[model samples]
Structures are given as structure tokens and as C-alpha cells.
Target: SVSSRSRISLIASTVTIAGAGALLAPAQSKK
Candidate 1:
């Protein structure tokens, strides 16, 4: 179950980072 849980968390973090990156893009472009 270690590998499975790690994979799930990895995916979740990836999604979160992607979403944050998306949100920051517009602000970055304005700079």
C-alpha cells in the first residue's frame, strides 16, 4: 500500500501545483 498511497499523493500534488501555476500565469504575464 505504500506505493499506491505515494502515487496518489504524487498525483494530487501535481494537480495542485498545476492549478497554482495556472493561477499565477496571468499575474506573471502582467509583470
Candidate 2:
């Protein structure tokens, strides 16, 4: 159970970072 929970958290963080990067990439490119 613990391992599964940690894996889920890791995936969630990766997704959050990816989403943030996706949102910021276009703004940076426009500059």
C-alpha cells in the first residue's frame, strides 16, 4: 500500500510539473 501511494504521488508531481511547463512554454516563446 505504501509503495503504491508513493508511486501515485510521484506521478502526480510529474504531471503538475509538466502542466506548469506546458503553460509557461508558449509565453516564453513569444518573447
Candidate 3:
């Protein structure tokens, strides 16, 4: 069974990816 810790890890990974994408957008537009 999955633990609450595992759920939090998944959410953290998702947020990291989303943050990276958000950061990348402006850099791309500047080029």
C-alpha cells in the first residue's frame, strides 16, 4: 500500500516539473 509520504513525494515532483516549465517559457520567448 502507498503511504502518505509517497503521496507527498509525488506532489512535490509534479510541482517541480510545473515550476521548471513556467521558468522555461519566459526564457524561450526572449530568444
Expressed as tens digits, the lDDT of each residue in 1-31 for candidate 1 is 9999999999999999999999999999999
Could you arrange the candidates by TM-score from highest to lowest?
Answer: 2, 1, 3
Worst 10 residues of 1 by lDDT: 1-10
Q: What is the C-alpha lDDT of each candidate?
A: 1.00, 1.00, 0.96
TM-score, candidate 3, is 0.73
Candidate 1 wrongly placed segments (more than 4 Å): none
TM-score of each: 0.85, 0.92, 0.73
- Candidate 2, residues 1-31, lDDT tens digits: the string is 9999999999999999999999999999999
Clashing pairs in 2: none
Of 2 and 3, which scores higher on TM-score? Answer: 2
**lDDT computed for candidate 3:** 0.96
In candidate 1 the C-alpha lDDT for residue 7 amounts to: 100
Better of 1 and 3 by lDDT: 1
Q: Give the lowest summed-lDDT range of ten residues in model 2.
A: 1-10
Score candidate 2 by TM-score against the native: 0.92
